[model samples]
Target: MKVNRFGRQAIVAGAAVATASMLLAGCTGTSSSPTASADPNATLVFGITADPTQTIPWTTTSEQSVQVLSQIYSPLLTTNKDDQPVANLADLPKVSSDGLTYTFTLKDGLKFSNGSALDSADVKYTYEKIMDPASKASSRSYLASVASIDTPSPTTVVVHLSKPDASFPSGLTAVNTGIVPSDVSVDSLQTTPVGSGPYKWAGRVANESISLERNPDFFGGKPGAAKVEFRIIPDDQSMVSALKTGSVDVAIFDNPVTAKTAVSNKTKSMEAASLQYHVLQLRAASPVLSNVNSRLAIQCAISRQDVIDTAALGSGTVTGPITSPEYRSDPKAQPCAKQDLKKAKEYMQKAGTPDGFTLNVMTSQGLYSTAVDEAQNVQAQLGKVGIKVNVQALDSNAYVQKWLAGDFDAAIAQNAGSADPNTMYARYFTSGGTYNKVAGYSSPELDKLFADGIATTDTAKRKTVYTQLSKELVDNAAWVWLFTPKEYIVLNSSVTGFEARYDADVSTLWKASLS
Candidate 1:
């Protein structure tokens, strides 16, 4: 699932200014050589910014949780480096000619971490739970097309869809759809998950750390690291220190300044383009934002480039709603690509608020390293257009609670984008989508666009459909699109074989080992 994932810190205005100045200084550091050959039994300590909100795979919308759960739970299908669905616990599915049914065959021998047999019943049960309304799974909307699951035999599962969905296999690749033993209770799995993944749950300390060990019963051979510990280090600088002191063998940094600092300290690093992007979501149901003109005023008032410069040290690309290369919308083509104070004021006048109005913008304090800075910059820009904005900076947990409940007039969010447009937007843009309430606006036209985007497997036709959808969203100011920040993976010199993925996934850590 595409959800919030970042370290948390209290809001401090001076932090942004300090980071910006450091960026201008052009920091550099010498490289270090590897000390020894890779060790398969070594324990790799991963430095993370925040603790996972929960460990339940299906119920969570937190990326932090996905990072941990992914290692413990194995999905029937997993995405390859190209972001295409590939076989994992089962072989590639066989699709019916009409595209409404999918048949999957389990591998010869599949066993959960606990040694229990995993079969078609487990796969069927997993999808059924996600489709159940009471489950409240964040990925529920992704599986909405599912009509029923038939387990014809212990090794085979047949899924029936209510309608044709070209992106269905990709949806199954998500961590939220990771298969589990049908006999395991949800309550037990929440704390002690059992699955057929490379690693098994070892232990966790509330907010300090979580550990995992190799799953001896895994179908896949032994992983590179025998044990992995995710050390929850909330402060970026502290995380850098941990890397320097050898306490953290690997870490991912969203803040360019901190990433540069780690490199300067002789740590090796790689930059990966992320599908995640910053966005300003306006609640169309709110009194001040009810009128499309009001939303347009806010969209035109702020500059996406300025936000990137101030918040991300200018290390990002301004983008619209979609970030996937195949169907990405051009930022230059967006109606409010360039800031126009005059146009903003005119729109405000048309909105019947020419004199001015106040809006509450909720943001996570240190979520994604620059959330507060982005909100503050937006506040200043909107002020110029006589749109008073009150920034409500909350802790990451509180911010997520409010964000999920649609509790604010406006919100600054870092949402995950997908390789497929439907996976990226359907949850928030479609009429029956799970997060449509959070979006606060939807129509027949918008829903139809989503339907068309997923109705066929034709790549060119799907691209055309998404292009129109992008236009509709930008034209109506559905969201004030911002920029996609560069995700930095910093590793100590002794760590090797770590590869980065475009989606900023850390699951590849299974292949990383200490030298």
Candidate 2:
């Protein structure tokens, strides 16, 4: 499931930026911050969770890859903190009256960091390549609305779609869909992607680090950090320690407790709601869980507040299917299931007189530390209602395999539906969704609602449709909604101009400077 796997990798990618020395330091503690570089712009080091799977956007799902690629390539658009689409590499596309065709105008005098002139041809080529059947772009389904591309002039590119899609602009803001030079081959792109962005790839040291230098000729203006080095530190605890010791200038902490540990007068921290949320997936095929009453009882049994307080360290919000709080502002949108043991017992009575059934809930030790804690908390909550849940924590890869195979009765995991509401909800609830295949869920009404939600550009109509969808999923007990995890970024006092993006994209560092 894309949600279970994809964006969560980025949590560690940005959070581990300040922990390079922690990996080498072992257990010997060093609480001192590193001395600031005499020249902040000369070099800046960022600790990342893991090395990117690949540098190219089309084939990779890792968030670390997206962070690296966001700096190497510029997308047609980007999103604000609210996830609203805004123009970046090009101005907003002018849509046809029928909404099937979009006309874009590129900025004047655009050039890649490699000195190649960038224009509409590059955009046409990149989109066409993604649309090709053999390209195997992970986002092909996301951008399937596009039927063909036409470049009428050097600065103008027109896209014809199979149908009208109001949320199409949001797809343009994806990091993997960045525009690249037309001449760069698929093989060349995998190794060294060239694009018109603020920075250019400089060097790579396998699993240790990846380096990028400021693009002197970039149209957006040269980056503040002349040289940026992203160091890989796999352990989260160590990463936080590195931030405290000043081995690295910046790091991201997924653990709020660890983030607090790194906070000091010399280092500052900011905690924001994450795009991803932890969830408990109940197997629809399981005879015990298949019953609607049982599912609702399970939902009512779990306490979101307890999970947040115990597992998340009070840094998260109880969430619904949408997860992101920004989209839940609508007055009519449905909220998550409230904790009601009375309701749970009543529903359990309807499910053939509850006599305590054992639910094996799986989790990943390597994914998020909170997964086990949340699972354990849920286990305790369900116990109160005569449901025994056995929490199983496994290695990440093994857990992913088990999850994809649908081998467990239940699983605790995290998923991000993307910034678009349609994409977010459709991914798990709609029939034949990425995660639904395992759950064996099929609903024609949900399919229709998702189809309509993406069909129109009208904000009011979209909200109404999604609000209904949320209520349906919650009422059906589609999944146990948990808390949206908080992402904490720790930065030294010397780093300036670093604004935290709602998503995991680290491209904002293009403007960041270190003292």
RMSD of each: 4.3, 7.1
The candidate scoring highest on TM-score is 1
Worst 10 residues of 2 by lDDT: 23-32
lDDT of 1 by residue, 107-178 (tens): 988999999999999999999998888887788887989999999999999999999998888888888888
How do all models score by TM-score?
0.92, 0.81
In candidate 1 the C-alpha lDDT for residue 141 amounts to 84
What alpha-carbon RMSD in Å does predicted model 1 have with respect to the real structure? Answer: 4.3
Q: Judged by lDDT, which candidate is best?
A: 1
* Candidate 2 lDDT tens digits, 401-442: 677667888888777656677656554566645446555454
Where model 2 places Cα greater than 4 Å from the true spot, the runs are 1-41, 59-62, 111-117, 128-137, 283-294, 323-326, 329-336, 345-353, 356-360, 385-409, 417-419, 432-442
